[model samples]
Target: MAALGMADRPITVGAVCVYHEMVSTAVEALKGSHIPVAAVSTGFPAGLSPFHLRLAEIHESVAAGASEIDIVISRRHVLTSNWQALYEEVKAFREACGDAHLKAILATGELGSATKIAKASMVAMMAGADFIKTSTGMEKINATQPTSLIMMRAIRDYYERTGYKIGYKPAGGISTAKDAVQYLVLVKEELGRDWLEPTLFRFGASRLLTDIERQLEHFVTGRYSAAHRHPMG
Candidate 1:
């Protein structure tokens, strides 16, 4: 893979978070690869399913060899200010994920406010989220600087207060090389380089790999490729 080949330099590819059904296949394919499997569970994107079904989705993903589980916290309940329900929902999903790392997707676009974003991040971390993710990559307006700042600040404060190093992941619509670099820069500036590693920081992107490859080619070669030119995965 081009990204894997680039690991000798400044950047490296992290885990590839996919859907529940794709976990087993991806895990087998990436067994000897550098990328880990991070599967989205708990009825991702919409997340309108019943609680039990969502929990089962998470459990199944972990059992299917996913090393990490990205579960969407109930935004409807969170927006309604049903703090207890939101807390319980995340707690339940954390239990279902077993030892698989849990990344709670706040889907920041739907939360609609920085204040709400901060509160939701706190709730997710307290509810046992290994990482508080920014978005689901389905919203037209996904990860923004304000929401990401709020979440990262919350993680820093929570670490000071509780000694837990909850991670931060900014997902959705983050498909450009410059955007990824800027996001990493923001994290380094705000949360420090201690949080710069893939464990504490991740950009949940679909087309990010291709974008990175283009940047690599532009650096190695003298020109950018045509839109149809794709690097081998």
Candidate 2:
């Protein structure tokens, strides 16, 4: 927080994401900074908790002041080709958000195939996910180029069919500035400039920020600093 506050130029992340228990603490720390506090709810990376418990978790997180909620979807719904069940589940999660932007984490790495990933992305948007995220950063594969491409195409197709712009987030494994730029380029080529804004696009790579700071420092000083020089906290 101090590092963010002391940056030479204006630089703020899309939001500070934390587990539900830390929502209030993040909210308190980011007070007056205009950065929304985002919480990972609905059993997070697993999403295997009881259905009612998942919905209740979302409600609790929002009530605790999380303006954004990242909820994981049940991979079983996709694996079993139960699109209706997946849609209904995401819809319930969205409703529970109560005006908080809902980011649906597909956990693409676990979905088994490109076809399933595409189908899951479409279902998530259809159910009112403000964004369709690529991974939970805990999956075995995390975010890969092919998975991201599939999700982006799904986003493009959904936008064409419904005329509603849904955001995209490629989380996990994107830790370098080069990798970050590659995703940015992919989004621009696949989704166009409109999705480039922070409101419509975000990288779930916290370590990317550190590398960015390092690059910026090198650009300004003609010397590359150690990674420890830039701390996320």
| Number of the top-ranking candidate, with TM-score as the measure | 2
Candidate 2: regions farther than 4 A off: 1-9
Q: Evaluate all candidate structures by whole-model CA lDDT and list the values in order.
A: 0.86, 0.92
Q: Which ten residues in a row have the lowest lDDT in candidate 2?
A: 1-10
Q: Give a tens-digit lDDT track for model 1, residues 95-211.
A: 898898999999889886888989999999999999999888888789988788899999999999998899999988888999988888889998898899888988888688788
Worst 10 residues of 1 by lDDT: 1-10
Q: List the residue pairs that clash in candidate 2.
A: none
In candidate 2, how many Å is residue 206 off? 1.4
After superposing all C-alphas onto the true structure, candidate 1 shows an RMSD in angstroms of 2.6
Q: Tell me which residue pairs clash in candidate 1.
A: none
- What residue runs in model 1 are displaced by over 4 Å at the alpha carbon? 1-12, 231-233
